[model samples]
Target: MEILEIENLAKHYEKFDLKDVSFKIRPGKIVGFIGRNGAGKTTTLKCMYNLVSPTGGKILYGGEEALKIEKRFKQEVGILFGESNYYPSQTVKNLTAVTKMFYDDWSEDLYRHYLQDFGIDENKQIKALSTGMRVKYGLALALSRGAKILLLDEPTSGLDPVSRDELLDIFIDLVGDKEHAIFFSTHVISDLEKCADDIVYIKNGEIIVNEDVTDFEASYLPRPPRQIRRYPSKRQAH
Candidate 1:
């Protein structure tokens, strides 16, 4: 069964317009939102969460309209943007404390497990964390709230290779239970190619490709990894 569906989704701005955007995210699957810059990827995701109002279209979560199921739907959805807007002075523990109040199903045990698993220091201020650590912290917060559907926008865009791989490993682990589904947007096609079950490509505010990853890869010419540098492991960096 489809967990989320976007039907004829469209959003309009003064200069740019996103039209006829449609897709489905099924249970136990990873759907990669792929597109070039200015392709409406961010806009589409914002609309899903009602952060940005859609001029036209309907979003359905489990066959019910999103607007109608706002309360229940919000609990099921967890969002992590490309760059989290965190107070630089706040520590990891402080951040989690503030966020946990919003979710009824918040799990402190799960949150601590992720903190330790990710090697994050709870006492360290947000400003002290590396780019990778910030993103990892964001994921921990989202997952601990018992989010069944994750909406990540460029979560791995600026991380090191080791961090990217680590995040991917966590994503793989999340889907292992067959209860979680993720829809993440990224310019990093190779990363998506590595793990995404399906790809939804958008261009000029229109969805041009929405299909299985294998089919999409088969039709397009392959490109090698962008960088060949050997990145130091987290242990080595520390």
Candidate 2:
């Protein structure tokens, strides 16, 4: 079954208009949302969670309107708009305390595990982290919420090659469970080659290509990986 469906999503700005944007994200897949800058990728991501209201169309999760089940949708579907650094002066520990208050399913064990795994120093303020660390920290918060689907926008933006590779590994590991999935936007096609299973290419606010990465590369994207590594179907039926 498809995990999420975006039907005829459209949004309008004075200068830019997103038209007929549509896609489906299936469980057990990494769907890479690819586009050039100012192609409405971030705007489309925001519309999914109602951060920005869509001009038309539906965001459906489990066959129900996502906004109708707003609280549950927010809880079960994690979204990170780029690397988050909302309160630059806030210590990681203090910020985490406040964040935990919002999620009923927040798992302390998982949170601690990610902190250790990412080597984030909780005592340090947000501004102290390097670009890579900040991204990892945002990931830790998103992953610890136990969300089955993660929506990430430009997650690999400022990382060095090594850091980007490590982040890609984490994305693969997270979606190893068939019940979990990721939909991330990136202009960095090389990163998608390493992990993504499907490609959703948007151009000028419209979906131009939606297919397996291999085909996408053969038909369009020039930089294809040596191979794609997909780790899916590692879970029991619910």
Q: Show model 2 residue runs off by greater than 4 Å.
A: 222-238
Residue pairs in candidate 1 whose N, alpha carbon or C atoms collide under 3 angstroms = none
Give lDDT per model, in order: 0.89, 0.91
Off by over 4 Å in 1: 223-238
List, residue by residue over 27-139, the lDDT tens digit for candidate 1: 88899998889999999999999999999999999999998989889999888896554998998788878889889989999999989988989999999998778888888
Candidate 1 lDDT (Cα, whole model)? 0.89
For the record, the alpha-carbon RMSD of candidate 1 to the native fold, in angstroms, is 7.9
User: Which run of 10 residues does model 2 get worst, by summed lDDT?
Assistant: 229-238
Clashes of 1: 0
* TM-score of candidate 1 versus the correct structure, residues matched by position: 0.90
Candidate 1 worst ten-residue window by lDDT: 219-228
lDDT of 2: 0.91
Q: What are the TM-scores, per candidate, against the unseen true structure? A: 0.90, 0.90
Q: How far out, in Å, is residue 138 in model 2?
A: 0.6
